[model samples]
Target: MRREGSKAFYIHTFGCQMNQADSAIITSLLQREGYHPAENENDAGIILLNTCAVRENAVDRIEHYLQHLQGMKKRDKGLIVGVAGCVPQFQREEMFTMSPAIDFLAGPDTYRTLPLVIEQARAGIRLASLEFNAAETYEGIDPVREGLISAVVPVMRGCNNMCAFCVVPFTRGRERSHPFKSVIVEVQKLVASGYREITLIGQNVNSYSDPEDGHNFADLLDAVSSEAPMARIRFTTSHPKDISEALVRTIAERRNICNHIHLPVQSGSSRMLDLMNRGHTIEEYREKIALIRSVIPGVALSTDIIAGFCGEQEEDHQATLELLSAVRFDSAFMFFYSERPGTLAARTLEDDIPEAVKKRRLQEIIDLQNSISDKHYQDTVGTVVEVLAESESRRSSEQLMGRTDTNRVVVFEREHYQAGDRLNVLISSATSATLIGRPEHGVVQH
Candidate 1:
């Protein structure tokens, strides 16, 4: 039976860049089946929450969001409420029990079955498709991207790392790289379509290996840069152990590759790292960081830090703080640990840290990072940096907002430029999070 409402769909994505890329693929698949994009939930017949399972609060947020959707379903009888991505894969039938409005559940690998699931849903059938596929790369599937200035191409899927605190291995399954030729083709297509920046995304992008040519992540990066010389290339979420010398060298040599690397060192203590099953110790991670900095001068380094983990001692916390002071990351994503279920940490270790202590440590981490970020941004005063103007600033349309090659946000007064125009800007003032600048004297629009 056909769905009994307008063929319009809305996806509220809540997660990392991988989820955003998945939403794009979902949009492409549904559009092929004649479904139009809806501006919001009220105007759509289908609403899918692409959820995350990394932290407990993320799942809680999605559950709370789903409970509020009951009113929308009451108003539109034919509305098909669904859940996709890591949350569905992890929660399974519990998602339906927790949120009764959900019509179907689809895992990361089962997105291709969405159209069929919707058809079954219209016939009063509720179901969950949570099977894992080792070889589902979704090759040749062109994403329906909305960005002209920047776009993300998922070069690979899943993770093999399986850190003790993470649920990705269970939710996203094993690592699988997209075919090399298909990835290059996607990059070429995006460049041809006028995309200025292309980010090759994955759970752990450094582990990407071409199935056909036995090529590695560095090889794939070299190929992408060679194929799309006009477009700037970037990648994310590199594992500390997987980062190779070749990868750092490739970034240094490639003129178009952005000079930013987001390498997540979850904790700073070697003992804490061992408890977390992080594979690499503090010394090894620091060595890798030193290597990256030496190879690529003036590279912007960012990281992820968890303040409190299972059995985290005060000494461990101090170690993280000391690491922050020593490394002085340009920025960081810091949070108190939220134990995820079914992970090695949850099953084996006790969530022993007191809530008060956790929050205090988190705040300390935040304050230290703020000061470090302030000093870094303040140093940028009177320097010239290249920025790709993305959109009008939120404060005023008279000002334009963009990002530097180091991934720093910059806002400057609007001149004759538009979105996607790359121009050099001379930094005049700055906040901890943003750089206020004006066009440079020799501004050349690319």
Candidate 2:
């Protein structure tokens, strides 16, 4: 496993929590093969950028970064540069042509072969491992996690629902859930190792079903909760159509499950929903939201909204605004539609919306979300919330930063507290993005 130069490796990850988890797994796999982590890119013999292709800008950023890396490769002739994850998967052989600095390409399901690929690259070989493995869940591999307080454990990989504007289904391949027992074991290990919070993540998490016994996502959640009762549990990127009543009740019943649901309603217009092939109508999404609210009162709600989709009119944009106002989401991840190549939208639909119109519509969505989020935070100013102290505040070392069960960021004075300490904090002030608090009752037990 030893190379000629620095055996230190560095991975720059882009995109979602899933990609972060994938990077951790990649680190673990490489570390097992005697590859140590580099403190930074400059010190590494191998540098892999785990990229995202959700938006055109993300791909542009990666391309720009690769251009910068070209100079570094020239400086160190033995430097192994590779691109992994979505971008490499989507781009395939074109990546090598696009970025001459890149020596190899590894897709989302291709990390197991990285050691061999790197070795080949060192021997003057350029290659790609982009084959999709429907059965590859990396079950036995332990990810070399970076953080101490919270970690993301991917419950499943890929997406089955091909929303026309989405690139996930094509990039990550078909849906496959990790073994039920394996996930529980991972959670137990994390809890035993003193990690306080775990997020079970997937592209479409609500559709996860164990291949062994056909146990659904709710069953998996309940099992994880029971396995690690002390650790807070969270899951993300739920498809609105797949969120069942059983799942809602499971969240309501479980004491450890955090009271937050990130249901992505891509567009508010039913016509737009149909165009995207989202598989759910606007009314159905609303009903699901209402059911969730009714079951878990005060549940912090978040969503993803795409503005200016194919054939979007002013009326459709207005409908989206109306939905935002009606739902009043605590937070939102909003973006203008970017037509991903090889997707249904790119193939069939016309990307007719003008760039200026898309930007304007996206700005309106942002403005509305900010107002709603501000109101939500303002309303919580007088209440006390349990905060899991994650790390020192970015602004000041004297303050500790954490998050509420509802997934709101909270910052409080650090009075002999450490990263994993859970504390009850009295909300003193608020911003749209953060809650400033004072420790109410010192450290909370469980």
Candidate 3:
């Protein structure tokens, strides 16, 4: 059903891949209801903010945006403003009190009900936020928009692991996997719609389990790969402890599965891991890495690292450096730990790490990782690799940028190529974060 005079809308998304996928679903739903996507906020009748609650900085930014929106709403009286995703899930009533400009507030799981909520809000009714549901799945709604080659499909929602420093468990609630048939159906549709790559997203993707048929994440991956052999398969944010041997084997067997894994090891010290409630030791993490490498030769490894947690000592910092050197991740997302309200760490541990010390340690990790990343790229020089052309290079129009199967960014000079085209490139040069290459003679079939 389409509204006769529905106006254009725009959604500004923040946070992880899950949030991005959620925004896509929202976009699809809005489009189905006759809302056209606007080019910018200034041109839209409705403005939606899909926010993040991962850090306090994110909250501050949202508040600043809300104040700006208040002024926008005052100028345009018919503007419909809404807040969705994790932030609204946590600060429901508080957000309404903070910004009277927000006409609608919807939680992560409540997106399916957004059309009804927005309709009520447009009728000049005060809208209340809906609580998050663990079992909610937006599987049947077709996403109206997607990236050129890569698309994110959220296979599950929320988190079961209560890592002490994280508010995810409290904000998102217990984990629940989406039905396997639904996931496969979505993947097939995406592949048929010209999508080449799919990354299965969740809080802890590897922990996904379908209770109906007793199928786990590995089984799900196999099913998807078998059904959609034309598309590249990948998944993210794997917990170190849950990465099974079968998962590694599946990657090795599948020709279209990407050769990259992002397993987060927040800390290196065993004591720190225990304090963080990570449920895996440093040795266990190393063994998992070794197993992954053994199964998929030359696979690129990446990780998330946090510097200066509550009680991190000099020795603990040294151990972290040692672990980095040993693992030699091709890339890392590094951050200085920030305590969040309602988290176990905030309540139990003292955030005693000096800011200067934390910054210094983070820099050290960055430098080391930079060197490691450079080495990893340098090793690939003179090798021919396949890349999926994404877009033109930021620096020069003459160059095109894409990513290899290992997920390393490659910039090359190529003509007569489009965004979704796959090409083989002969590597000529390497840097810390990029590979310089030229188009080779052949194309690799998917």
Top lDDT: which candidate number? 2
Candidate 2 lDDT, 267-373, residue by residue in tens? 88999999999998999999999999999998999999999999998998999999999999999999998889999999999999999999999999999999999
Clashing pairs in 3: none
* lDDT tens digits, residue span 1-446, model 3: 21223478889998888888888999998888777798889888888999888988998999999999999888888888999988887877677987989998998888878778888888997676668677777768877655668888888888999899998887677898889888988888888887888889899999999857869999999998887787788899899999999999998899888999999998889989999999989999999999999999988889999999999998998999999999999899999998888789988999999999999999998999899999999999999999988888999898999998889999998676667778899999999999999989856653
If ranked by lDDT, best first, what sequence of candidates would result?
A: 2, 1, 3
How well is each residue in 1-446 modelled by candidate 1, as lDDT tens digits?
22576689999999899999999999999999999889988788899999999877888899789878887777668889999999889888887888778999999999899999988898899989889998998886789887788999999999988698999999999999998989988988887888888999999999999999979999999999998787788999899999999999999999889999999998999999999999999999999999999999999999999989989999999999999999999999998998888999989999999999999999999999999999999999999989989999999988899999899999998887787888899999999999998887644556
Instruction: Please identify which of the two predictions, 2 or 3, would achieve the higher lDDT against the true structure.
Output: 2
Off by over 4 Å in 3: 1-6
Q: In order, what lDDT does every prediction score?
A: 0.91, 0.93, 0.87
TM-score winner, 2 or 3: 2
List the lowest-lDDT window of 10 residues for candidate 1.
Answer: 437-446
> Could you tell me every candidate's TM-score relative to the true structure?
0.98, 0.98, 0.96
Give the runs in model 1 whose Cα sits over 4 Å from its true position: 1-3
- State each model's C-alpha RMSD to the native: 1.6, 1.5, 2.3
